[model samples]
Target: MSRPPTVWLTRASMLLVLLAIMLVSGPARAHEFRPALLRLTELADASGQGGGRFDLRLVAPALSTAGAIGEGDLTPIVPAHCELGQLRLDCGSQGLIGELGVAGLDRHPVDVIVELRFVDGTQVTAVLGPDQPTMTLDGTSDGTSGGADNDGVFADYVALGIEHILLGPDHLLFVFGLVLLVRAAGRNTRTLLWTVTAFTLAHSITLAAATLELVHVPGPPVEAGIALSILLLARELACGQTDETARDSPLLSVNESTKVSASGREALARAENSWSWRYPWVVAFGFGLLHGFGFAGALSEVGLPQGQIPLALLGFNVGVELGQLGVVALLLVLLAGGRALAGAVGLSEKTARLATRAPIWAMGGLAFAWTLDRVLGFWG
Candidate 1:
């Protein structure tokens, strides 16, 4: 018996969904190579009148379940200068107090642990808890002393921003989605360049505004929104309707054909067709705004120096852009090389065309899986 058109479509959709799911969730691979390093710097009161004794404690687990941080833990990994409170006395005009250093510790979501104790035995910890009040270390005895210095503070902010984007899975996933979109769309070199540029411009605006306190959007909502963006992209891919140009590309047609066996010839055709120069840039610009806010949240956690907010914001944005560019570069190289090889081998263009569907389906599935996970996480 012949299947109904609707049934066939449903089956096809389901298959596509499954493929996307597998692509994303196939491996429980570690998203980041290394955890963010937690650095604690302490300055003690130089008056020498206050007690030198203070408490040092860590609220979060310092190691993963794999026991990778075994033996040499927070205490040992911490730099020697700050370990014994030497750096505390070295903060120039700022009265040096007791310093405790913790390093090489790993945690998810957030890193960095700090605790302060007074001679009277009163202690403060950086753990986010009701009992432990959050304290802003403003480089002053009164907690509001230092006017934000532009130099050191901005440098730190920029470094942190770069590190956060590099290690952030959500950000990476968003970037990966963009790359897939570009690939599927068969964007030309000019288009790819412009798209990346647009994304950079868009995100940089939000990141700066948000970081500078000019705009304040809550973290949770922004994160949830980011996950939603991923879902939207996945939906687009699964629906198999992006732009008309992307869907009807001749290169894609050749790549999709199962009859193509020559990898070299296939590669060459892909190179020739990969040059659509406008649509992808527009898409990137739109999505880049969402990503920038995401980056802002991470940078804000460390607290930027008011005076150097611009520098820090700029640096952080630069880092994120670099990471995005790196991903795009890799994708271009892989696709270009693959197409070249296929073309040389005289692969059947039809077979090559058919091959493009696998990656699309796989990415869509993964996006769907991530979306589901995020939704459940939010509600559940």
Candidate 2:
């Protein structure tokens, strides 16, 4: 078979392997909430003295009566604050809330024991719940604790940005394509660095503009365009041609008089492949902007706190960058190891070329499948 034909077949086989791997791995799920938030409020008397009315806000999810209560019983185990025993609990219409008498006002920090028992025989004790911002004794609304002053909107936007990118399937596929294309071209490190930087800059620009209401693009068209971009890229890889002309060019030139040795020809072919190292980066930059807008849309849904927007946005962006780095690192390890193994196996230059090219086709095919699914989702 001709070189291009062989490359196409190899890619098809690899696509099947990737699809199988994804199927067997199963869907990913998030972990449960461990420590709930605990809010401590100081009460004041009419004379401006500290009244011993300690309001404890215990944050726990509401459960149905049919569901298990704390460790099958209503009592929770107390470790330090209370003697080594279980405390009586109250189930309210909203959730369980327990108030303890505050006797000491001189203490800078007070320790309290909080526990929960589930009907399934699960018990949990915590010295403190998740930290919440401090509130003042005065009835006047303070800047802490989900007040109007909170920068919730910005924070939600950033968190949404991170979550959307991490969980997004199409974004993952595009990143994979970037990695595969970089590996195929033999310009791994330089291409990866620049590609990531370019994508970050491009998306951040659009994210800021769109979030601030400085720029607007129709949602449906953007989504459809994003899917189309993926399909075009996949086709480019599958075709194994730089352009339409290259694709249409004859697959091979026959010459009986001067038959190049397989080893020499393979070396030349490998060198030639390096020319396309930047191609994947170009594709990634284009699609990444669209993905960022998708992130913005999800953030809009969650709604951010105006007061805590900075902190929330920081946390969310950190999560996204961490996830993207993780994916890229895994791809690098897998592809790099595979390349080393092929070299170590002492496969002839010709065979190695054919083997490595197989991964590109596989990557492209997967991209195609993903593009089709995404396009259908957009239309439907």
Candidate 3:
């Protein structure tokens, strides 16, 4: 039995409505993995030796699934003269000037952004990652020393962008769906290029807008919408899949003697008529806009440099594109190798079709699970 066009349209409409509701409703919460923040403010002393007392506020990531944030998860490596207390760090007369490092990055990997304020109102900020756990804190009141400049900002934000995209399960799944859809639709490299470009452009617009405070939306709904987008793509892939040998299969009527059914023709027709199948770029661009908000939310947690906002934004966006391209290239190569190996093994047509369709099924299942989890997260 064939599903009517109206039925498909209705299902798509319902999905859109659900996404809209998610966008409009829900309280905001932390949706993405964000870098930890460590703030240091100098406390003045009567001795006036540049104030050895310092106040500390450390916001670290939760180490356990139970949402328990343990300060012990991150160890602070200070100067030999400085001693870290519960809420205050005493640097003696030296006044907190030395190489600063945070250990235990290996146990819970995340970038740690350090912001230090000197007694003279000079502020310095630096980002520490697992690769580079230490940074120099010169304690200069010049506001230039000990902080990241334009080059450092570019490098840090770019790396953050790449890490976010690669480690972001939801975003990766959506991109994976796009690649699979393009391949299954037999789209050429040009079409794939346009599709990816459209997605990148759309997301870049929203990421900048949201990060710059040009636009504001709740985080949870945006997350739910992203999950919904993946689910919708998965549904489309499952519905419009054709057999591996669909081109070679004979398209004969039921009255004629044919071993293969007309499923291939039906699937091709369905795919051709479907809006997402015909112009996947359009779908990607639409959902990509929603995804940009999610990206901005994560970046917001890291906090951009006031002096180099544009540069940081550009670097992060570029990093995301680089990561996305790498993933696409890797997936294409793996797919090609799998096809070649299957052909060499002389796998039957039915087995080949099953193997080809397995990913779509798996994607759908995972998308559905994510959708449900995100929707439920609205209230929590």
Candidate 4:
């Protein structure tokens, strides 16, 4: 009663194509939490308070001239009416007379990149998001300036890093793929731990290098590559392939014990265990390098001050690791909880096992959509 192998392959291919089209042709919701970039210029003006002058530009897709921005919106750098034009929000005057953060940010959550430049050539840059909406602005010539405090350097950047990873769906998807890869290795906690740690270390290396200007790669390509990595994992997951074979993966025994014949299991094991296949951590380390570049590109744009680079980098990397751990832990809990419920309902173990393939397909579909969108974006 089983479908022919060729028929199954054709059907799967058609479904993949359909999924790609359905996801890419529609209005994309890829960036659900894009942050606002705030560029503040401080210069001395004859009509300025204490001879200080400032002008602000806030850029975000949410800022547009078409709609009405109520008082509950993001607060600009200075006290003045905001006018939105073409994804740009502007406020302040030549004379920065009003007090800093007069109204603070609105009730809602907003992410802002605060950049400050003084006449004395000092630069202070920091990320202001929903977690932090306001900061003091001082524009004194020949005066010391700082954006992030030394005390909070580790904590703040850590929080920012965590926030960025959580907000980024692509990154989350990549991590989810990793979970599938590591956990599938007979749920060997040691393998999973090492793979995750290796990934963290690899990305941390490139993230630091890129942020410090030791390395530079376009953000778009890196993002596209991350999506591609997820797709690769999906393929592996679907094929039941890994760095092991029938003789290697502990799962091979489990697969044999199932209703599946030993011959079929052997085929699955040998094909997956082929020398051409990559180890889980090896794949993670490789793709993680690209993902790190993506992270660095974002962090740079988010305005980490040159002086506080080290602390910010550490904190952000830590945050990313924490987020990754959180996700893996959550997945484990859900899987355990689901299995318990399934058993309670008298579901056969073999039937329940079928659900394991869901993540592979879901990841594949989403990754394909993102890949198509990003590739098209290069020209669009």
Best by lDDT: 3
Question: Model 4 off-target regions past 4 Å?
Answer: 1-33, 44-50, 61-108, 121-126, 136-148, 241-259, 271-278
TM-score of every model versus the real structure: 0.59, 0.52, 0.79, 0.73
Residue 375 error, candidate 3, Å? 1.3
lDDT of 3 by residue, 1-380 (tens): 99955455445655654664455333222234677777778887676535678898777765322344475878777777889898789988777777777887776677887777777666666788788777876755534354466677788778878877887877888888898878766787788778877888889999999988999999888887887888899888877665532422111112223354477667767877888888999999999999999988887765776556898889888888888888888888888788778668766565555555566655665566666777797786
Tens digit per residue, CA lDDT, model 1, 160-275: 44555666656666666666666556656666666777878998888888876788887555665676676666555434432221243223333244333345444434533432
Residue 79 accuracy (lDDT) in model 1: 23
- Tens digit per residue, CA lDDT, model 2, 1-380: 46765466456667676875466223211111112223333334476543433344443322212322233222222112222112222322212222222222112122222322333233222232113212212122332122323244334334444545655655666666666555544464777867765666566656656765678876655555655565565554444432111111112112335445555455445434543443656656767687667555544432333335455456556556666777888877776676567557655444454554455555555555545554565666
lDDT of 4 by residue, 187-215 (tens): 47677777777788998999889877888
Superposition TM-score, candidate 2 onto the true structure = 0.52
Indicate the residue-level lDDT of 37 in model 3.
73
* Top candidate by TM-score: 3
Q: What local lDDT does model 2 show for residue 197?
A: 58
- The local lDDT score (0 to 100) that residue 12 gets in candidate 2 is 69
Error of 3 at 28 (Å): 18
After superposition, candidate 3 runs with Cα above 4 Å error? 1-32, 41-55, 63-69, 83-93, 117-123, 139-147, 244-261
Q: Which ten residues in a row have the lowest lDDT in candidate 3?
A: 247-256
User: Could you report the Cα RMSD, in angstroms, for every candidate shown?
Assistant: 10.3, 12.7, 8.2, 6.6
- Which candidate do you rate higher for TM-score, 1 or 3? 3
Candidate 2's C-alpha lDDT? 0.45
